[model samples]
Target: MHDESEVAVLRYGHRPGRDDRMTTHVGLTARALGADRVIFPDNASQSEETVEDITGRFGGQFAVERTAALDGTISEWEGVIVHLTMYGERIQDVEAEVRRAHRDEPVLVVVGGEKVPFEVYEAADWNVGVTNQPHSEVAGLAVFLDRLFEGRELEQEWPDADRRVLPQASGKRVVDADAFGDGDDPGGTDADGGANDVTE
Candidate 1:
């Protein structure tokens, strides 16, 4: 089994209002996609408590940190650093090599919200691009993570989750642990024999 904690993300920028939502989504995506943690620089607008709340509600023992020295932190990390950028080498070409080279070490993937510095590229053990076109950072991170895990991330189970969404053909079903049990097949159909909407 692959250790999801071996992979981490560094969100390089976080501007209020503009980047608050995007950055929060970045952290959430990373957590959902099996990343161990996300580090936000001191310039970030989101609070550590908010991230803590997310992890508490979700089901991972994930971590979130705010740092003042982004470069210094990267330099001190005892692992390979991979910077995602459109200007970098194609992901398909470099991803395999990067995985092989750092198979035993942790990986720190950097996603920038603003124009990254030249030094960051130089500091990266591998600079990879999902696509050489303008794209959403959230999408790029998701794709890169999916590729890195070879789709195994999707199969992960949140054993500690207080709530979970049951698979349905149509409509939505959210089950709270407090209101359901293992033998209880809470999934029910509507009058049309299709998935029914369950409201609190």
Candidate 2:
């Protein structure tokens, strides 16, 4: 359902119960941070539902999918593969190259849930680390995507949204996203990698 060349997230792992919220945030981060889609393991149905439900209300073309062959998805990706891991090359050293490559090919971003298999490291075109320090994969992914887009994702406009948040110095206020009838604006979100102050 997607073109071979697009920026997508491959949620490489999931641990039931223990990781439900985390896994769900991974998908949400992928959407809010500029990925076109996220591929989850078939067993992560709850996370998938929550992410999709938010998308339905917030409005965007972000896609959430499931696959049984997570490894095959990596092996068969038609474009560049990026695996985010603390052990890999620092993002500072390679964001330019990855961003340049992304202009020409699809990018599959892999975020690990537990201990990632070694083969995933070998298959990646670039194994990126936001920092050498240990941190949450959600934090790592957010940093990388921000650098990848050079911060353009922050200004993302959500079209066809049910609500639009007004940025304010204080207090919360929301307006219908379709108030303008263009379906091209929305409230900034508190969801995942969204711009801060969703309803100020």
Best by TM-score: 2
| Per-model TM-score versus the true fold | 0.84, 0.87
The lDDT, on a scale of 0 to 1, for candidate 1 is: 0.75
Off by over 4 Å in 2: 1-5, 180-200
Q: 33-76, model 2: which lDDT tens digit per residue?
A: 88899999878998999889888878888999999999999999
The Cα local distance difference test for each model comes to 0.75, 0.84
Please provide, for model 1 over 1-200, each residue's C-alpha lDDT reduced to its tens digit, 9 standing for 90 to 100: 24533888999877765777677777877887878888987866464556666566446667888888888878898989999998889999988877675568888999998778888999999888899998889889999888887788888876565555677676756565454556453433221213221110
Q: After superposition, how far is residue 51 of candidate 1 from its true place, in Å?
A: 3.7
- Cα lDDT of model 2 overall? 0.84
**Backbone clashes counted, model 1:** 0
C-alpha lDDT (0 to 100) for residue 186 of candidate 1: 48
The weakest ten consecutive residues by lDDT in model 2 span 191-200
Error of 1 at 196 (Å): 20
